[model samples]
Target: MNRDGAAPTMKGGQFNTDPIAAPNEAATAALSQAEFELFAELGRPRAVEAGQVLFRRGELGTTMFIVASGAIDLDFGDDLVTKRLGPREFFGELGLLIGDHARSADAIVAGAGLLIELRHEEFQRLVDRNPGLVCHFLRRAIMRVVLNEQGLIRRLRRRNQDLEAALDSLYATTHQLNQTEELIRTDELTGLYNRRGLTLRLQESRAIGMPASLGLVLVDCDRFKQVNDDHGHLAGDRVLQAVASILRSVAGPEDVACRLGGDEFCLLVASSNAGDVMRFAEFIVATAQNLMLMPQSPPAMCPVSVGACMVDPRADWNDWYARADEALYQAKRKGGNRVHWQDAALEPV
Candidate 1:
């Protein structure tokens, strides 16, 4: 289309001699007055109406069109910008230059006017008659094709960059969400699974079907409140940390160690026998006893009482907890530093 958006003018079946002013006139390969006259004499003149389709994309074409009057629009699909040709502007030249060339854009009439159609034979005749003019047109056409291709490449690169940026942002958000969830499930002070974390882990384990054998051991630091009262809470914290370290040292890879609350801890171990659970509980008591006997021991370093039970897969968490807690109460009543074991039926073992 011309810069003014006006269709080419015609008078008495002929185009005016004025120079064609196209959009981006410097880049457009418009035919000069002499060239248009030459093509008009050599080519066939066909009258076209508005809304008429000259050729569609992918159609085999052997003819080129010179717009003698009005305008023709070339529609290149796939988000590419369209181009319009006014008088003296030509399209479909590749069809004559390259035999059986597929049309790249759909050529549709924008306004009714005369079009000069040049078939392969007529184009060859014109080429032989004036090789210089044909070469000049070919050079301009090549440059226009290069410029259009470069523009398309630029647009594609920008789209790729935008897509990559969106993916990066999504990944960052997902990573931050995972970190936040981990923090929520962890004990801030003890570096162990908090109560909520333990519950989640148990739920996950249950989802996969409970193992045939499991052991639950509950440990409580005897006189922990007295330690916090006599010595500062800081020392009590250190004692708790030391106990936690012992639990970590003895826990198997498959076992879960957790701090239920202040001075109260739990261990979930994989074991089928009541003896195995009892041994684990006894080990914790012995380890705490050794910590208290260490030279220059921290103040109020008391022993721990332990209660353990072989778990029944059919039983709920409350039943398991109640049995273990009862055993714990019995151990506390007997004396602070000791181990107690209960069978799956809640009978003392």
Candidate 2:
């Protein structure tokens, strides 16, 4: 019997000469009794022991084998299923048909038995003596080669599809993660950087030693609570959005406009000049005052106080915030709607 535990059968419904048979025997490369006996007479017999390797994959082969009384295993490797041939079954026909052909698999003996080894010369003699029978075996061998090629192509196609799907899934997951990170650091109402976003930006800039010199400007909507009380919170939100827009307009390309919280906004300017920071702060205040004079002014329009200061790289965010806030307090103390800025000199600890 073959590895499938089925009795080997002959072609054309003839009884297989082997004592054992193969179940569901469709078309095989096994030889009939007469063919085997004839080849046995022409070919040399090799006595093989279990675990003996007849030939390794990739070696140049010029011979074929017919299992006379034992089994042999063909290990194709690379996860391909191994095939076992029992008595009367033949393998490695390609080597005989195509001289110097590379062996595709390792042929190892599964048990101690005799194998009929046929070289190219012996195969030629058999073809001359019995052309019809040799032609049938050749056809079966060719069919097996075609079938194996088709099967390998199908498996490779499936693996390629699976790899593409995995790559697509990974791309989608990365896109979603990026969007989520943006949302976390963004202000929904003003579409500006939130507090966390501003802090992160500053940290990143420092890490890269960018923006050789920096400045911070803080702005506060004057009498914001009164604006919410006079109009509704909705109007107050619109007012804040308008202020954010003004800051955005005044900020440079490398600058960051952020709404820290509530009615407070800030700008991280990529400049060290106190005059530049003061000018930015003044521009914001003037813009807000101008907004109130517009025909379609914001509801319960109010002016905003501004503070400006150059940053000291050695200092932390808290120090920067405190210095800017103090200047803002000074502007507000002057009855709001104005700008105040500190000197570029570093403050003593």
Candidate 3:
């Protein structure tokens, strides 16, 4: 796993022990056998018992440790994250030579662990005494830091790719889920809101606590089945698209327009007054009629009948919708192409 908390591997049992492969060895040459012997004199090898914590997370790390013969376990925490290190593999140099930063993980003895530790001050003194070695050691230190950073970078890049792929997969899955949801909520033939979508929208509109009023519109295509029977399903689809376009253009940004199966459509308007809704509905009716005057799409002429209901300050949304539906039925019954308003006395408008 990386810093992003992604687990790359299940087990925490990776260890490297070749002395030649130790990070920052380019500087190690300066510390000849004699100088290294000096370090041995200054510091001593320490042994830690199994399961014992050698260093803890968040504590200032000063000394650097090199595994001599045994292995050490690094724990991230109760998350059970651990990394193992064997002979010659070292850690803590990043914090030791730079500004004091807390240790990122806790190091514990895997079984019996033997480690050589070099205190910061003693190590610095040796570097200071051997100025020529300073340059080489600095280069080595930089390489180690770079390697650690690169490892982390590589891990992060991999994780990002994985997350991106996962997100795309999730999007595809959600799209399929949405199609399934639409099947449940939408009319198959007209691509309009079935009864389910209208109910959901009504419920959602009511759920929001707003001070403003709400508006509803119910629309029916004038002589829809006649066009379908005369021009065929393709022409019927064109008519639906034309009316849908008109509705989309006329409705407010916050408003929702949905096909309510067959030739009927509905609109939900929030935070608006009855007058605005009426004007919008009028626009829809007029625009749809104008479109019908154009060259008939293939073979059918399409026009729409619109009916609207506005919210009453004191009436329930259900009652308002019922009145709107009544008005729509009335528009169809009285005339094929016209607009009607809900009786304010019957509900909220």
Candidate 4:
């Protein structure tokens, strides 16, 4: 007797946990009606009461039971009954076939039932009288083992596929999250870093110890309000976009380009010295000077006043911003369209 009680031989001679042919079960263990009746004759009839414990799991089983009328419930002491044997069904035969076998599951009469119990002595007597019984039992027993193993393998494969799908879904979600976070820190208008992005860059720069020169460049479009009034706000917007383009082209991926709103834009560059900062500022000043707003409006020179400063490792981010602001103020005072760089380390651009 096993967890599924016993296997029944189906048409064409096959065995399964249940007698019915199932796509999931084994091939049929076919037997003639005469042979089945001869087998059934080996059992002795017994009346079982409803709630009667016929046999229990782990007991050294010596007898097999066949359900003649009513039903038999199979359990393993748990409330979830595993199987129910109805009319014309047989179970526990494996125990009788194999000498000194222990019952793998418990059998209880579901209701008042008519059962035929066949002991090992009766089974042996039948085998002696008709040796064909030995052949039938061996063939059906082997088929049961094969079919059960195949079922377990199929279940395991399905479980592995589910786990793989879960892992792929997790990876896709993580990638989407990364892209969303990148968008959150980006400016909608110019595709540049926003103020929040710039602040994060500053924090990263400050975290690094000395021997690093962090560069800051402030680019302000000179007389930007006059452009809006002259051509319209659209023109002013175009001017600002042009400035952002120039700054982006001059900065590397390691550098951060940001629009600080209004006519102010900033760049944070990873520089080895002050010269790198000055060269970047010069490129912005040169490119912006050649910008043409419209063909109708005489070449509108959108000159940008740039203020460049190198970070003092000992100084904080605010100190560097203040120095860059002062440099920008100097460039504005000296008439826009020029670079005012602090530190005599780099010549005025």
**Using TM-score as the measure, which candidate wins?**
2
lDDT of 3 by residue, 279-318 (tens): 7777877777776677644744476777787766357656
List the global CA lDDT of all models: 0.80, 0.80, 0.67, 0.73
lDDT tens digits, residues 16-91, model 1? 6444345455245467665677789899999999999999999999998899999999998887778888888888
Can you rank all candidates by TM-score, best first? 2, 1, 3, 4
In candidate 1, which residue pairs get closer than 3 Å at backbone N, Cα or C atoms, i.e. clash? Answer: 1-84
135-195 per-residue lDDT for model 4 (tens digits): 5544555666566567657866877897899999999999999888777777777788888
State the lDDT of candidate 2 residue by residue for 1-349, as single tens digits. Answer: 1222123356688765542333233134466676677679889999999999999999998998889988899998887778888887887778889878899899999989999999976777988887876765666566667667777899889888988999999999999999898888899999999999988988897798866678999999999998888778988988988998998898888999999999999998988676777778878888888888875534635799988888887788899899999988988898999888766453211
lDDT of 2: 0.80
Candidate 1 or 2, higher TM-score?
2
List the candidate numbers ranked by lDDT, top first: 2, 1, 4, 3
Q: What is the lDDT of residue 34 in candidate 1?
A: 59
Q: Can you tell me which runs of candidate 4 are displaced by over 4 Å?
A: 1-137, 204-211, 293-301, 344-349
Which residue pairs show collisions in model 3?
Answer: 193-259, 310-349
